[model samples]
Target: MAAFARRKEQRLSRPDPSRKRALDARAAELVRLLNARERFCTASSCDGRVIVTDTDGTGIQKKNCTWLLVTHDPCVKDDVMTALEKATGDVVFKFEPFVLHVLCRELQDAQLLAVRSTHCLEVPLSHKGTLMVSEEYIEFLVHVANQKMEENIRRIDRFHKGLELALEAAVPADTLFPKGPEKSHSVYMHRRKRRTAQEQADPSRELEPQDDAESSLALFAEIML
Candidate 1:
């Protein structure tokens, strides 16, 4: 009865995959549109965000944050978690005590996959894809995920622009960060250069969002076409 009561409590409190799917089903059309857009990001989106903190010999630190926020469609998250669970017949998640925090069942390097939500610094086991998953489907998810990210970046860009404009107008930039995507993992950006007092942006510069945005969308359309 105690076990039963505990299970009931979890069922009430958590937003499991099934609940996510049910809600996602309501916006299947939007999902299809997003899947088309994500494939355009030349900047790798699937890997977890790896924020690099540089400590020069004397220990004065400089930080560079990579915004590889791979927002997910509910159905894709459900299917991937489901596949991982099915492939390994266990409740293999962080919440499960005794579940190895660093997994190596079907993977080699743990630095590849990341969960977006933790506030601490930790690396995770990354896997490319499971058996028999079609390229078309993965591409579909990539497109949608990229689209969602593009939309997110747009808001971020706008907020930054708003800040610049506000400074120009002497108005306080009270910009808001959207809460649409979950921060499951940190983007791992290889430190390409040391930060100077003048260098506040990321040291390793990837293609700007606008640079590859159109090409990515076009490439996805070509594939789908």
Candidate 2:
């Protein structure tokens, strides 16, 4: 556990490999800012992108989904359309939830940091995320979305600052680990669809190409202590 914390600290002091592969200029900046914080270390992030797949192509076109324009940076409609020009078939602009995962010192620290970020610091985190706690480490998955890509990066920067400031201050007494909002009843009531025989036979055909987005978890809310 101590070693992990030390690693996070070291990461904060150095350049991140993620920055070099950032989808855009803005995403690289967010990666730099969030990883630079003392309270956390980023795991992954993505600036949503437009994908062009040529249906005529064969066998899981590895390079088929050409990134017309990928960026963690802010986006404008004109720029998006321009990138689409290169696309051949099944043009899909997937604005996935801007996601960021980070490791924290402890569960209590994650709770305290979350509360402050929501109420005091005002990070525009998605109304959903995961706070995975363990004796060795604590992880936070921040998910948010916006039509304009830049806004999400700005929010991430604010979230990082919020976590840093919260760590410096004393923990609040009222809600040490504030509860998240209850899940909608409808979510539980809904039944999953069964795959057809063809899908079962060729499961790989049904599988969508993996994107950078993380899998969804139980929804969460901005906590206030």
Candidate 3:
């Protein structure tokens, strides 16, 4: 009886090469079909509990994973909580309150589909693309970014100078800036004129005064502001 059992075990352990080849061929075919498809993802809150699910190939339930790609079985984990981490070697979706719909091109453009309850919902990627971000608009954004950067530099320079002046006079930092209506350009210009009238003002600092060094510095400041 023992000899008969051993012989039976030996026959079962022998490799079945032809069957293995058939299985491999089937897997290759499935992979090709899956690759040609794209998976769409969406996030929404339903009721109190978040339901994260996936629908593939005409809105059928495909494999869910750490990644939510159009993939075969063998998911990331054996079970899932809020979201499943899929290691299907497909695109992974982070564990979140979201759902993904995997659809073929026949359904629509891959980007336009999102998962609804029964049917996969079509997210309209349609746009008034005519009012697009033109080259001019792109250039405008760059210009605005540069202008803001320049303004920031001017602010830093002004703050540094104000700090130095405050230290020299042994005054509080806040004293460098006049408050209320005195904050305006007209007020600053008025104060400058008064200082000039008092002669305590540096004649060199006068706006149009022929002091080469101060006039050049003032011109540079004006451009910066």
The best candidate in terms of TM-score: 2
Local accuracy of candidate 1 as per-residue lDDT tens digits, 1-225: 355344444543555344123332323322232223311111111211112121222322222312222223223444433334333111111110000122211121122222122222222212222333454554464444444444443433333343233222221111222243422222211111221211446456565443343222223222211
> In terms of lDDT, which candidate is stronger, 1 or 2?
2
Question: What ranking emerges by lDDT with the best candidate at the front?
Answer: 2, 3, 1
TM-score, cand. 3: 0.21
Q: Which number leads on lDDT?
A: 2
Report the C-alpha lDDT of model 3 over 61-177, residue by residue, as the tens digit: 354322222211222222322232322222212211112223232222221222233211122111221222343543443344334434434443443343233223222212455
- The TM-score obtained by model 1 is 0.20
Residue 76 C-alpha lDDT in model 2 = 49
In candidate 2, position 97 carries an lDDT of: 36
Overall lDDT per candidate, in order of appearance: 0.28, 0.40, 0.30
Off by over 4 Å in 1: 1-135, 170-225
Count of clashes, each model: 25, 2, 7
Better of 1 and 3 by lDDT: 3
Against the hidden true structure, what lDDT does model 3 obtain? 0.30
